[model samples]
Target chain A: MELGQKIENGMEGRTGIRNEMQMSFDAISENEAFARLAVSAFVMPLNPTVEEISDIKTAVSEAVTNAIIHGYDEEYRQENDRETKKVQLHCRIEKDMLYIQVKDTGKGIEDIAKAMEPLFTTRPELERSGMGFAFMEAFMDRLEVVSEPGCGTVVLMEKRLRMAEEADEL
Target chain B: MENNYSENFKVIDNYLMVRMPEEVDHHKSGYISRTADDYIMKEGVGNVVFDFEDTRFMDSSGIGIIIGRYKKISYFGGKVFAINTDTRIKRTLMICGLHKVIEIME
Candidate 1:
């Protein structure tokens, strides 16, 4: 079915939705857990399967972690005296698809292609797996990244939900 | 079976057994890695077993933790084993090419 037609058909049903939410918070380690839980809760109405929910949580955690650990370079933050660096997350649900966007206004990647390579990391000394993008791609139906050297980075991820077993009630 | 969501580590018959929490993501990976490393080095143990029976969720960070532990123990000629994995987590391990290096046991 065409994407637009599917959305239209979905809206006619009781379970269809066109909801969206955006949140901005400090780029701190503790917020990683918060981000995962928030995303999980936001998608609760979809009644996703256990495995599906887990996949979504994991992908969100990776993106947020990347924003905190790699995006805001510590040296840069200190030099500029900017202690309140923030990361933004936007989530939207349209029909059977869930879309997530994580943005960080920190040191952007010079080469996104190289950064996406599995096992490639700039901080190997820190034991970073460098598998963030790889996992996000594997778990989600689609993943995209846009960044500039000094501007910032944004990661967009999309996943198609499997029909919930009890969706009829919705 | 009782479900314990807490992460723990203990020694069983000369093998270090690490009990993972219900969810293994970036938040818990740092603590798990640091604690496991300390135990392995201090105890001078060779073999390590990761108990994932209680783990319902795991991301790539889980893979990285396992691989990191494998590397640490293997440096001393020790082996790493994983147990109690469900189909989904097993598939993740396979996708990350961990099954080729770490032994999975029932």
Candidate 2:
């Protein structure tokens, strides 16, 4: 099943998506850098400013890291199926707006609202700063989280580049 | 100010100086924390200063690293300082209300 078609969202109806991509990888800490760097490269065509690129990269890092650390519980190994738990990185670029969705099929969030609260971490003993969702909300123009217990979680984020707005003015 | 560099770690003026990596994320947090703690426990540094001069990107994991180190030393009357933070790092710290907790040297 394609992750893009898994859920219905209000954003799917929007047209003019210039580009789109979906990738699935094993849920592992090492892939965090791979995920964010790939996203930075994907958005390069938008000619984002250094600050904008940093913002996008940082947001992507938080979402993917959460999926790995919280979702699969560090090392993902299924006792029955032994299938590798996967984290899906999906992106859509429409005009100047970038849409991102990081999905994971693992132990889903029990309470998303409480999870989003700043400094409210479920794993403080791990020295988690409890700022993952907070930073995502700060860096992205819009952030939405949908999760179900014993199923999975998808973090949806959107950002509009200033360069794109300047182009619209011309 | 003896530059005794040991694996991205240094000690200056009794402060443990941790030179942050280029990209600080969850993958690297564990290692960073373990090494910094060694200094706090073994070397007995008075304070901790995180150097972000080479860091171009940092996620909440960076915040965790800093906060974890701060907690380790604070009970012993140690202070945590962050130096060379770029706009992104600064904003990350500010968003989490970390500026109030740690001294940020811009």
Candidate 3:
């Protein structure tokens, strides 16, 4: 299986310290908790302080919520006939660093650059702050988004664990 | 959980107290903005303090909510203060530049 496929196949606490979770929801705003729970499980083992954990959870929530709210535009709720739109998440921990990838099989971002700007959300009517990437970038050390217009979007984030003293200082 | 907003006014002193619910993110920003705007219009209470002791998580959107109110209140010769932030909420608010604009109290 390919790396992404392998990650999807319940690769948790194995050779490379990777964990993958899969769930398909109606992509409704109210279902944001499901996405948060999945990412929390992946990040909990990193031994992040309580505050850090919350930060990670919030970042994950924003990304997955965007996938549901913006990417699918609430269409997934009515797509009972086909069940096409779904959001996926994959995470791995390697060498004192955590990497998270959120994938969405919905409308791909047409303008990645514009989408990343602070407070640049497409769903203002829904009160979206358009600060999804901004929050992710603020919490994690690095973030990357790869998408093809007709395909999908994959958001990759990496956070290096700070040394004990460094964490205390901050 | 849904965010709840309520305001109390000190008639003689003209200070406003805003009680914000948990997790001020994208979903709750607009509601917060509207509530603050309403307080400014109805009570004419400009001096305000936000109590975040119960708030667990806040994203960048939350910053916009605070900044919007800060700008509005400051224009009328008033200031805003935030109180009792947990570590997680504190870091998030700081990262979004809220620390520079408002007074933070323990």
Most TM-score-accurate candidate: 2
Give TM-scores for every candidate, taking all chains together and pairing residue i with residue i: 0.87, 0.89, 0.73
Provide a comma-separated list of chain B TM-scores, one per candidate.
Answer: 0.90, 0.91, 0.83
For model 2, the superposed segments whose C-alpha errors exceed 4 Å read: A1-17, A74-82, B1-6
DockQ, model 3, C-alpha based? 0.32
- Reference-based TM-score, model 2: 0.89
* C-alpha lDDT of all candidate models, in order: 0.84, 0.86, 0.70
Looking at model 1 chain B, report the run of 10 residues with the lowest lDDT sum.
Answer: B1-10
What are the per-residue Cα lDDT tens digits for candidate 3 across A32-92? 6666666667665544666567767787887877776667765544553446666777777
CA displacement after TM-score superposition, residue B81 of candidate 1 (Å): 1.0
What DockQ class does candidate 3 belong to?
Answer: acceptable
Regions of candidate 3 where Cα sits further than 4 Å from its true position: A1-18, A74-85, A93-97, A119-130, A162-170, B1-13
For candidate 3, give the lDDT: 0.70
Candidate 2 RMSD to the real structure:
7.8
Q: Clash pairs of candidate 1?
A: none
Give each prediction's root-mean-square deviation over alpha carbons: 5.9, 7.8, 7.4
Cα lDDT, model 2, residue B102 = 90
Q: At residue A16, what lDDT does model 1 achieve?
A: 62
lDDT of 2 by residue, A61-90 (tens): 999999988887743345414365889999
| Model 3, position A2: C-alpha lDDT score | 90
